[model samples]
Target: MISKTTIDNVFDTARVEEVIGDFVQLKKSGSNFKGLSPFTDERTPSFMVSPVKQIWKDFSSGKGGNVVAFLMEHEHFTYPEAIKYLAKKYGIEIEETQQTDEQKKQANERESLYLVSEFAKEYFKHVLFKTEEGKAIGLSYFKERGFTEQTIKKFDLGFSPDSWDAFTNHAIKKRYKLDYLEKTGLTIVKDDTSTGTATKMFDRFKGRVMFPIRSMSGRTLGFGGRILTNDKKAAKYLNSPESDIYHKSKVLYGIYHAKQSIAKEDNCYLVEGYTDVIQFHQTGIENVVSSSGTALTPEQIRLVNRLTQNITVLFDGDAAGLRASLRGVDLILEQGMNVKICTFPEGEDPDSFSRKNSLEELKSYLEEKSQDFISFKASLLASEAKDDPIKKADTIRDMVVSISKIPDVIKQEVYIKECARIMDISEAVLFNTLAQLLQKEQRDASRKKRSEKKTMEVVASEKKPVEKVDAQYELERKIIELLLLYGPKEEDFEELILETDEKGEIDFKPETQTKTVFRKIYLDLQEDEIEFTNDAFKELYTAITDRFMREEDLKVDDFVKVLEPEKAHAVTDILMEEEKYSLHNWERKEIYVKEKKHSVSQIVSETILNLRRELINQKIKELSETIKQQGPDDEQVNLQDVVDYITLKKLLSEKLRRVV
Candidate 1:
């Protein structure tokens, strides 16, 4: 269990912008910074970070959160893990009391997988440098590939011994369970049918050079292994099979290293393998990644899209594989990204080419060869067509299909015109073909979705209806915005109240001051048991209450920083949604009343004060009823006097203009 003091300390020290900046590259956009949405596929940046409020919101995906929340959402880290990550980054020491074995056992499965992966990484690193066989084989292989010591360490290149039981034995010695090892696909399990015997095993990446595949946040999700020996039977490269923690389609190799550079340059250089990324990055072209030798997937494209919309694909000109890879160009365009292709000279791939050139020379070579996908494809197809009308029509249809895949109408129109110019065809003809393709695809997709829905209906008999999301959140958001902006100050206003007790008496009471009234209204809200319906609003409310109860101070700037990212974003969005209207100097803004002028701030304070006063009076009346039921106790009367005097003093203070 972590103490409240520790949690408070974590909140006090962690800055939302600073923490999120580690993973997201944000450039200044007005009062806030904007970056590609980390949660969605986007061509233009819609992820907004407000430094003033220390919160971020991705308008594209509606995923916003404080720093801790970002880690929780993006990296799948728990609250404690996020706090620990921030503490480590900022060099703050953490103090923990203790945890039971059961509590430790209850830790999430994904986190345990992460822990296992992290442990394996360290073990492999140790084996590579510390063990004689690992040093001779793994270290030599990497060095022979022209990898520097720094590069080898940066990528955590490692070796697993030829012995089948080497990793399994070591893991067991560490008291790590084989169940998780098998679950993560790090170990293979076998059950003998004849003998009715069962045995767990490890075979996924045995006896190979290990390449760790990391997620966007730099945590190892899986491993890729390359066999050095010329084994005719076994495959050259083997990757970890799909597991709970790793999905090949959803991940891209080298993303963790290249994310910042991609955002900085607003472009990602795509290649085709693990070595390509390493070699390119070593050559100081840091904004490069690979599809890890898989077919280009939309999910992979989206990963790159989150960092940049401009992609330059590097290919080996001599290889037939280059022609085969051209399909990915359309995939890139389909995601509404700017696609450029740059092929190396005959007989050189990105790996060899990068190794042979200096950083400046490589950059210059790429600059000179880079061409947009449209021109490159048209010119390439033109040669294949050889002025044959039939082949040319086919080529035009292919281009039209690519154009149809673009989600943005404006981009689609622009691309159609460019394609027509390049193909020397009429824009109308190309548009007609594109429209046909788009319609076909939409109908096919709808049919497929309906078919899948039928299967789901059979498996799940019923579905839960979405509950109506209350709009009271809007009101709470407005109130929080006002509190954050003007909680410290006071304002004057008028109020209406019954002058007499339950017996019908008349009395004089003063209007509530703005700050005081806000507080009173805020407390009355608690008494009335009204709750914020928005999840983010609820989070913000809890944070506000925590701060208010602890410090007795409400600094909007400070409180927003303490909230989760989503809540912080909700607060910030509301605060900035309205246009700035100024009452020049001391000209007060008015609120509508019974055909009379009322200052806006004064009305707010008065409303709060009146609500709180009404609540107190209600409580006093209940006590009076109880007193009438029995003989009056001196203690009860004393408490009543205290309440009455406090209310009278509040009214008098408002009348004398002493508070507001």
Candidate 2:
């Protein structure tokens, strides 16, 4: 368990914008920051972070909370894990009590998997530096690759022993569960009937050097291991199988280290392999990442997209590889990111090229050689299509198809003009082809939507009845929102007093009283014996009221940190509900909007009166039902009670200025 002091220190030191900015690109918007929703696939910014309140809200997903909550939501971290991450990020020393064996064993499955992966990383590093075989093999290989000790350590480069069950045996001795070991793909387990054992276990990456693949927050999700010796039957590289923590398509190697630099530079250098990223970083190019030898995935593209709108793909001299990578450019363009293509000399790749040049030389080469993706693609294909009319026509259509993938019409036009210039083709012809492709795409999308709608209609026939809005629940929610926003605020309220006028009609006389907002709300609810119908709202009401009563200084940020996750989520939702209106910039158009603070008293009184009326109506409904079901003796009493409740509701309604 992390000490409370450490957690508080972390919260105090960590800024919500700075923490979330590592995962999502945030641009300044007035007093807050807005960015594309990292939790959802969004084109426009819908994620808002308020520095003044120290809270964040994702209107797209409806997830909002403080810094700890963002990490828990985004990174799937536990409370302690989120705290530790913040403490580490801010360079705060953590104070934690050691957990007993039973406590450690009770951790959730995902956290256990993460723990195992982290343990494996540390174990592999110990093997690389401390063991003899590792020094002779894994250490030598990395050293020969022109990696310095610091670079190797910075990337957490390590080695697995050559023996099959070496790591498996050691992990078991350390009390690591074999289930997690097999699940993480660290140890391959199989039935062993001939050996007279239930199962056989062996290290998956045995005889290989280890490269820990990390999330953007630097959690060890898994590893990518490289086999050293020549084994014709074996693959050169092996990655951790998809598990609870590691999903290769959604991960990019070196992103944890490159994210800051990528955002700072406004560009990301994407390469093909792990070594390529390491070499670039070691060469003073910090804003670079790798695809880990897999084909580019949209998820991987979006990972970089969160940091920058530009990507420069580094390619080797292998023409086949370069051709294979062109499809990724279209993927990047589809995500609305600008892409540039750079290739090394005929005999070199990024790894080899960087090793052969100084930092200045590498920087100069990249700057001089990098070309806009369209120009590079056109030039390369034009050369291949030389003197072949059919190939040249196909190439032009191919470029048109790639251009059609771009989301921006202006960018599409720009690329089409550039393609025409490179291929010596007519701009009108390229535009016509693009238009046809786009039209077909739209038609296909429309057809899909119609088919989906038909299926949904069938499903809708059997769907559950729609839920009607609960007026009482809304009133309860409004009460909670008011308490969370203005709980500690003192204001004068016009309390409605019921009386019989001289003409024998019910009248509502306003009685003025000054009290704290929370006290006024609490007294009214207590007087009526009202309870929140919704469980979440009821819990939050108790928590907020208790805090307001007990603490003289009620800081929403500090108060929220102590609530349970569900209540904390509700508080942020209620507190930041009105912030959505600010996103429209209503004031920028010279239209002034009324501030809620100016009418807090009226809002509070109306809310309480509305609740009273709703509850009275509910009672009258019960009395009416009882009158129909009961004998004549009870009917008159129930009828009179209903009349009295109706009279009171009318007085409350008049106070609210609502028609009966």
Candidate 3:
């Protein structure tokens, strides 16, 4: 229920680049900022943000919008949440009217779960600060572990007491539903057996220090809890079970806090635990996130890929620990990202090392010790292999397997050469091994997929991502492009018609005229009774006609903002895509792009007339089929229909000929 005035204030104050730049690594590209698409796994940046227009277009995902739209898309936020987030970030005060009872009841189930998770985070933090047990155990433990008060507050660290039903009872008293509490894995629900009348519910993270896991935009999705005791039967660390809003495979710990830093530095340091990430950031390495000791997933790798392509994984120094993380790091390599390894001294982790060393000393150690993936993996394995030929062969094969995971052919080839030089093996041999590995992997995949599907597709998954562009769609896009780019500009348009001379010969008669691009196109299409067939383009066409008729001038930003999200996205794609041609300035090189002033009539007539001709041609084809279906002895009405269709076709053909 945010007021429209508040939303406008947020829009006016928030800069699109500053907002998106927190989540994306944007490099200056002419007047816009360009970065890899956060929505797709792309190496070449197709995501473009225009400061002047206050809009962004991701050609890869076909998503484009203003600052609010980007937040809603990137953060999975509702409309009001997006507005409030921007308002808070830009220091704009929000004015919200109270919702009616019916309006409050309209909140969806997914949003309820989100509300529950957020409530749990606040409750846990309150316990840590206010309660006696929390202060003695949770706060004391964090302080003893070298976390300062600022760090604790920055991360929203919290505590869950040992008492069962403490959080559950509190949540219920606050009008939260138990269904959502259990769904988010914050409370455990148990059924009574013999009595069957009573149900048991207990706190899930009791007697633990809590770390709230957040999405990239800082919404609490789940929690990671670490136990303070060394109970032999219990697991030390427990995380919130998977829920509707939280998929562990898709979430990265500390991503919310580290996203801006990662983009600012243009590099990210991959660690293994929450404490490791916090300690690193505290010691001046802000671009860091942890996998929370879980194996890295492709989804998690792609989350980091939006900010930077380069990753320096800070692994434990032990040989076994380094070897243990190889498979996980391979997932990073598979995403077409650059990978480096920086291990701490023996028996030290990122947490210990960062806390012990000065900021400059820690940075120097990282810079001086970091090595590329191939070299790091080679030397570490070689030391373990010693002079054993079998061990060395195993090491070589392992390195080859990792190299094959790289999607970039050129990067794979470069790494293969380096591996060969380091392992002292033949490049051909390693290349053959890589080919064998890929072939076997492909076969395994085919068998698994074939088992599930009765029929196998001939096309590969990679080939299908690129959709085929239809001719009609391209033409429709071109029309919109022309109207959006040059609609307001006035230009000379020659008028020409085919005429007959005294000898019955065809001749040309041309007349000079001038009009705005909008007026000429509108009149041309209106005269023919033509309408765009595509829904998106048709909607745009209607809006354009209405605006040009009512307003003294046409403006793109106001027009784009009024369209629906999908239509707005399409408009932006067309506008931003066409900018490549519109913004291309050859005058800088002393070579001017030739103007088409004399051909303006042809350009305008062709765009409208060709579309009309296509529509007529389709009608003619339908009439021919209808005539074939009916015999020559058909009804008089059908016969008349055929004759009229033929006449219409001939007239349309003559029009096409005249234009030529």
Q: lDDT for every model?
A: 0.75, 0.90, 0.84
Q: Scored by Cα lDDT, where does model 2 land?
A: 0.90
Q: Each prediction's Cα RMSD? A: 8.0, 2.0, 5.0
C-alpha lDDT (0 to 100) for residue 309 of candidate 2? 95
Compared with the true structure, what per-residue lDDT tens digits does model 1 show for residues 364-388?
9999999978778778778889879
lDDT of 2 by residue, 1-660 (tens): 888899888877889899999999999888889888888776777888888778899998999999889999999999998998888888999999899999998999999999999999999999999999989999999999999999999999999999999999999999999999999999999888788764789999999999999999999999999999899898999999999999999999999999999999999999989999999899899999999998999999989888899999999987875777799999998999999999998889999999999999999999999999888988998899999999999999988988998899999999999888888989998898899999999999999999999999999999998889999988988998888788888999887676797888878777889998988999988988888889999888877777776884468878777777778888889888888877777898998889899889889988888888888888888888889999999888888888888888876766678521
Candidates 1 and 2 compared: the better one by TM-score is: 2
What's the residue-level lDDT of 532 in candidate 2? 89
Q: Which residue runs does candidate 2 get wrong by more than 4 Å?
A: 195-197, 511-515, 584-593, 658-660
Instruction: Give lDDT: candidate 3, residue 322.
Output: 62
User: How many residue pairs clash in each candidate at the backbone level?
Assistant: 10, 0, 0
| Candidate numbers, best TM-score first, in rank order | 2, 3, 1
TM-scores of all models? 0.78, 0.96, 0.85
Pairs with backbone N, CA or C atoms under 3 Å apart (clashes), candidate 1: 64-566, 65-565, 65-566, 66-564, 66-565, 499-506, 499-507, 500-505, 514-605, 517-609
Per-residue error at 258 for model 3, in Å?
1.1
Give the per-residue lDDT digits (tens) of candidate 3, residues 1-660. 888899777777888899998888887877888888889877777788988777898877878887778987888778899989998888899999997767756788888889999999999999999999999999999999899989999999999999998999999998888999999999999888977844899899999999999998899999999998889777899999998899999998999989988877778999889999999878888899988878889889988998888899988866575687788879888888999999888899899999999999999999999999999999989999999999999999999999989988788889999999999889999999998998998999999888766443434443557576565676777788778767877877655555677986554466767988888888777777767779889888888778878884667766666566777777788778744432334567677655555555567766665676567667767767787787667746666776665665565566567767
* TM match of model 3 to true structure: 0.85
